[model samples]
Target: MDTLRIQRMNMGSGLQNASGTDKAQPVGDLGVWHVPQYMPGYPTAATIWPRVVIIQCEGDVCPGYEVTPELGRGEYLFFLPTRK
Candidate 1:
């Protein structure tokens, strides 16, 4: 048997106005970082589980629809035993 999990996480950031010339960058600094507090319409969860962690940043690219990382944000999807 195999176990799979799908979770939607919002890091909390507003969409920049289409007119702005300034490009948006990742919302973090060198070392530690924080997720945005308020996101309209979406109710903030009282208890936040910090188990999920971002492992690495592969790279950035423009993929027709939008600019997204080539490998995307790496994080723990779930745990599964190896099939033998």
Candidate 2:
């Protein structure tokens, strides 16, 4: 339920990424999958109030779309862009 809401928010948020694209949006239509703490490359143990998605997940640290330069490199949010 919350994940669905997040997907909607991701679309309506109308944000972009470093390359001037909405690629940070979720990769699933109705699912927002975050990196689990038990996962090998868990980015952070902080709260989930973040705006980001895995841009490239082939590394130890997944690069995410930084909603702002100051949000740091933590890519915790995951969802598919509803606009697509």
Candidate 3:
């Protein structure tokens, strides 16, 4: 059976290569899939929250949406792929 696996590693701001060389490594499987950002509006402006959906699995494995609570400021959420 084929499935999508999400693996996480601690970069620690010191990602190194096999030869111990300093290198900038990606945070996720695909090297930082998406970066969510927000900026507050002016005094008369309103706050805009962010909503993101990431399909971690291939084909129809994923549930097509997030099952966890909404993401807060600077917070991240991970979901497991669904199996038939």
The TM-score obtained by model 1 is 0.19
Candidate 2 lDDT over residue span 4-84, tens digit each = 222112222223211222223234554454432212244675655544443433322233332444544444444332331
Model 1 misplaced regions, further than 4 Å:
1-31, 35-41, 49-55, 58-84
RMSD of each: 13.7, 12.4, 12.6
- Flag clash pairs in model 3: none
Model 3: residues with Cα > 4 Å off, grouped in runs: 1-61, 66-74
TM-score of 2: 0.21
Per-residue lDDT over 40-80 for candidate 3, one digit per residue giving the tens place of the 0 to 100 score: 22233345443344444545233223223234332332333
Worst 10-residue stretch by lDDT in candidate 2? 4-13
Residue 15 displacement (Å), model 1: 5.6
The top-ranked prediction according to lDDT is: 2
Give lDDT: candidate 3, residue 31.
29
Q: Put down candidate 1 lDDT per residue, 1-84, tens digits, no spaces.
A: 112121223322223323212222332332322222223333354443332223222122111122123423322111111222
lDDT for predicted candidate 3 compared with the true structure: 0.31
Which pairs clash in model 2? 26-79, 26-80
